[model samples]
Target chain A: MHKIMFVLLCLLSGCAAQHNNIKLANQLQQEPPEKILSILSEKEPDQSDFAQYYLNLGYLQLLSGEFELSIDSLLKAKNEMLSLQATSISENVAAGTVNETFRRYSGYPTDRVMVHNMLALSYLFNNGIDDARVEMLQADVEMKKLAQSDSLNGQLASTHLLSAIIYELLDERSNAFISYQLAEKILKERNISLPRGLKLGLLRMSDKMGNDTQYQYYSKQYPVLSKLKQVRQKKHQVFGLYFDGVVSNKVQQSLAVPSFNGKQIVRVSMPAYTSVQHRDQHNQINDNEQKINSEVVENVDKLVREDLDKEYPSILLLTTTRAIAKYQLVKEAQDKDPILGILANLATIFSEVADLRSWNMLPATIQFSYLETDADHIVVSTNHQGDSVVELAALKQHVILSTGLSDKVFHYEQ
Target chain B: MKIQSSFWLAIVASVILSACSTSVERLDAQQQIDLSGAWNDTDSQLVAREMIEDSLSRAWISKFVKSEGKDPAVIVGRVKNLSHEHINTNTFIANMERELINSGEVQFVASSANRQEIRDERADQDLNASEATRKEMGQEYGADFMMQGQINTIIDVDGSTQVRFYQVNLELISIKDNRKVWIGEKKIKKLVKNSKLRG
Candidate 1:
């Protein structure tokens, strides 16, 4: 008996397990798979076959092997079914069909137990097994709470199967197989055919303990499981994203990989990305600046600022070969910008200042990147090439790098 | 008396003619050259400035710095000339830097090229024995930022007019933070009339 269910002595008239079956079926416009799942699970069941919509939609994504997203949708349907399974109590109990709360949900729409089992199976078989088991654990925790109230619910084999897969992955083999055996027994007693690979594994374990008939039975079952596996392989399509050679290196940089030393190292400093920088940029103001309202600011100064040199955070270093330098200037020597003289003069002053300041912000501290084209890597124009037309179109390619750091120089990339 | 009068007038006319022509041209052995209009050096500067500023715009430096990030005080560093020609990208950067700074959105660190002038001024400020004693200025921090790069150019001529292209790139790095925070690029194109090629 499912513990969450109750026996109503008074039969509510016309409710006949058709609680929500009055609506017409309609399809939704294309949307993110997650949304479709939610609408299906939340709609009234008997009045409309909303559950079927979820089931069919989820099936398409699942069969396509978009496991994480597919499972998310399936779980929504599972949640709806579980909620519908809850019946109003009459302070009494019944057995057998009375505990079919899953079927008796809202409209008594369909055989929902099968749906739960299949979802559990799908979660286990598809990608990210651990994620699937996390949901199953939540179900178990909820089911346990219900049992104390009604005493009708018993251990569900589907939940155990999910648990077994998780435990096996976690290397708690003994517990995993114990759960697996319980599921096999419950399934067998229901006269369901045990898939052969699983049946064989269990039989082999039993046979090791001297169970002869069990060993022989599952050995025969192995061929069928093997065939099912082959069919599944043929039915499923596998797609992959391939990055070759230097291209892979570029991708790694954009993704921000940590260095071999297992330290966070970023070559190009995007200090603004840090929460501390955000606080500094948005919150802290110099005395010279005018004051603004406090509420207008986001609370970001809460964290302490750490030195970046010591931190060595992981970084994505983006590079490009297809780079062009173009400018627009109205030249006047008589009115030659006094600022130009000042700007040029900074170099000489800084070089001398570097000696006085012992390599402070003086000079030599400035870093630069080179624009490499087929022509040359020259930094300054001798004559008038910088204003050339058709610079960017002639670019070769771009290099996006995930790079490591060192005390001496920033590594090109790892 | 009539012959003497004609001689005086002729002398006056010669003086006026010499005075009018002399300021306009200077003798170089057998030939005289004109110094008015544009000098080769000024042309060098115009072409260089155009090239560098063009590089800056194409580099899209503003798009990076002004993009929802903290405005760093950029300091101008070395605009070295590695080419045979006298390359001056600083003048180009100065214009861009002013635009960046004056927007009231950005700040520029004191240039490295001016550090000693600052120092010598500070040094001149010190007390000395003589009434004519010069003061040495006190020291200041290295610029909180540095912006510097190079400019390269290509030129070709079709008769009197020439086509030229220039690229100038600048990088801004913070001193205290040691972060390369900004990059600016600009390129210049021009058609200049060549007096030497005239018919």
Candidate 2:
């Protein structure tokens, strides 16, 4: 009877904590940019939410066109992320024996990779091409390092794509082709069809290099390429457009896995975006705030799902082991004493709280398009609403947009 | 009580472990240490010493001194960095400058970046100081030869192993006749084996 009572108490407490956390997140989402920045600044280093707060704050500042401030905040976030990733044996033991929630919130691999991407974008947004180039190179180097450690991720394609664009703008067509080839291979291996813009880029590069066979290969792969001819030194070039939206939050999912006796139910909290197919949804974009031809390019949500699927086996094994061990401990206690049994069950439930921590401010979907016009200035809009206006002084420009409430715009010219 | 004590013990252990940090030991500046196998002070120092020794021993130094009956004035030009890494080319240039000046075989002039500042100070001195101490403009020594260089790095990485090759090539060219006086090159190769776990 006491064990039953203890279980009830534990469940109530866990539920309350979870509810409060959700409330905090929702509050943060609704808060103003200045308010978010101030809150993040006020947070102490010892606070559990310090790292997450900075990530949110950095992203907020990034969207507000405060690139310098964002760089500072993002660097802090990077330091925190690094420390969290360096998990000691003691932290591991605590998580296993006491409570998984006791461990520091090391962000998901995707979250860490996005931090580098955002930092690079932040520099790019400020028109610091050299610094942006450095950041992108660093991002590629980091992904390579992660690959060496057998860590599979989804951001490699995006990073390579960004590098290719930067190289193209800098008039390094050969380098751009190399990055584009890498991106194409990664996407192909992941079974994702190439984006129209990427195919066009490959087609243009092959044509420029005078590789007739390679140009023919891409031309066949993308039917749209045959309709659009490659134009290198035109008076106006079609610039690429990328739209970003908020990534989905985490939710708990209960899975039944085979165990020692029968099957045990375990709760695994994962990014809710991973379950939803975002490719079907199209974001409406206006060039210079006017309706124009646009199409969906890349959905990061699907890539994230593919990465999670690759790690599902390990997640299942570890979660099943934890569940079985807890069940056995509870059963042993019940055999010893009824009160002790209740306490053990209570401890297990409270300790088994899923690791729901992630970089929630990331975009759920990333869409791309190519706009060809003679206008030197264009106002970008999403969903029939004007977001931000950009000036294109060069022949080629790369535009980035965060279609969230911030409605951020960053453009690069060459 | 037993369970409560065990829980507290675990918490205490975790706190102590989290607080622990790696200890560091200081070493001699000249001692060579190859961590990460990237460029380091030892490599920089080695290249500096060798390049300086080779440059001064060239026939141009003797020929110029014999013809002009004075040490040839030299200026350091822009040292282009065409490598993958963001190396401080200025540091390498400073090393070369120090060695060339110390050898007393050649006179040194300010770099283009420094010449503007030096001239501005001289102008300021002319306005603010006594005439005797006021340095006159256009009295500066013109360089007989300019030393310029480029640093290049090539890296090949496979799995947990990587090989980095760095080549630094410097040229001493006669400003008057547009003739190449001396060319010096130094190469370094490092085979770095990073652990799979750490990479």
Candidate 3:
């Protein structure tokens, strides 16, 4: 009888499962950005949702061309993350009694990196290049923190590349070269192969700085670096678009753990985000025969998966312990009285909700493209669809056009 | 036992309520309080004091006083902010102007924008005010020297550590000979601790 009860209790406590946000994710996919923003903005900064709400609302605002509002929301999300500390007894109790989902929304590391990246993009779109540079610098700081503490191997290549582009815009070649080198090093460390555009940038910059040795080194390293064409004399520009697909949704997993007696079962639910296929479409523009292919520059999904993988062990242990304790308590109540046992069992069953919360709006992948164009008017397409024909009158001479879900262009000369 | 538990809950509620109540206390304005690690009034005042002291100690002021037999007519020029942070250079500029004017060692003239406003008022006086008090526009005192400056910053960050270095450079140029007479520079470095948690 005791063996049967133990089996029943173990079966009652389920393994961790994902909290499903497929409905919300579907809304994000189908609804217009403005509508989504309006709906999400209503619940922003709510105590229950806290960090994730701001994260989603801010990104939605970014997609809707409200750069300032997006920064505001992202900053709020950042503040929430900063205010959270190591788990306290209150949090532990809350996780046990209510659910882990009800616990404080201390954000994931990747979420923070994305916040800074989005803020930089916001500043860049609003013609605040200097502010954009600062935001990118802050992102680099955050990345370094994660790398040092979490033993993450790579840097945020996208943010660093953006910083390099900003430096290039300001005509600060040395800073740009250093940023590119950091991006290259981090990407290599993380086992991500160097993209042709980045290698081309490194090669051209070193050559211009008269670093013949460095230029020769990269040329030999990339071998294809020699074959890569450069349009140096005429002023040309490249547009980069980064698209992040829908991130994995969280789902609820119910496990039944056998109790101390044969007749009883304890059911537990935990939330998780399962990895899925990432569909990324790149955008590129061509002027004459010089067209730069769009590359998948950053994979945000992989970073998120790595974070989850690191935390899974601890999370599982915590869930299992909580389940066991609750099951034992119910068993003790049953030994006392039938009514008390029934009440305890009912309470556990009803409150066994999985913490199914995440920043559901995050894209799984980040894609980028480079175009060499001198035209004052250029039509760039992403996902084989032309979103907009960007006017370059404001960005003549040298231009850097960047886009995420929406597109932005910057044109400046020193 | 139930009554005792109720009493404890009531006490806890009151404590929480008291904690939530807002309270405000005023502090001295001159006190240096670094909150966001951004440029603050203390920085502005410190730069103003240092730059004024350095500028007055330079040979330009005494040389002008010796050569022309009067205090040099000085005017504030453009103070450009080339730093990554959005700093209002005017805050410190006004502070320095106050220090220079109070020193009484330099005859401070109106900057071009201020002069324009003065000219506009003088023009108004020409039409509306008494003839004896009507001020002439072109007869206004021309500055012998102009002070201009630029604010530049360099930031280095690693993990949770950030070091921000700021350099403010001011130059007093002779309008007649276009010779730079006094160059005053103030540098500030701050080691700021950043929150390692990102989101």
Per-residue CA lDDT of model 3 for A201-254, tens digit only, reads 788677767788988888888776565544354445564655645677666778
Error of 2 at A38 (Å): 4.0
lDDT of each: 0.36, 0.67, 0.71
Q: Of the pair 1 and 3, which is ahead by TM-score? A: 3
For model 3, the stretches where C-alpha displacement exceeds 4 angstroms are A1-22, A85-89, A96-98, A221-232, A260-264, A384-387, A394-414, B1-14, B35-39, B67-94, B107-199
* Candidate 3 TM-score versus the reference: 0.81
Q: Which candidate order results from sorting by lDDT in descending order?
A: 3, 2, 1
lDDT by residue (A1-414, candidate 2, tens digit) is 565567657545644544454454455445544555565556443344556656777877786778989988887887677556544566555545444444555555665666776777787777766556656665665566567334346456777777787777766788778888988877776667777677777887887777788888888887666566644343445454454555555666654343454323233332233355443333443454344434444455555565556656655665666666777887788789877866776566655655455566555555555555557766666552345666767655555454544455565555
Give DockQ for candidates 1 onward, in order: 0.00, 0.17, 0.25
Judge candidate 3 at residue A147 and give its lDDT: 74
Look at candidate 1 and tell me the lDDT of residue B68.
31
Better of 1 and 2 by lDDT: 2
Model 1, residue A77: distance off in Å is: 2.0
Model 1 chain A lowest lDDT segment of ten? A353-362
Cα error of candidate 2 at position B162, Å: 4.4
- Candidate 1: how many backbone clashes? 86
Summarize candidate 1's per-residue lDDT along B1-199 as a digit string, tens digits. 9999999999999999987784555545424332422123444445444543543454335654666365445566676442213334455456556655655644656665576676666555664435566543433443456666665555554534445555556666656666665565555565655453111
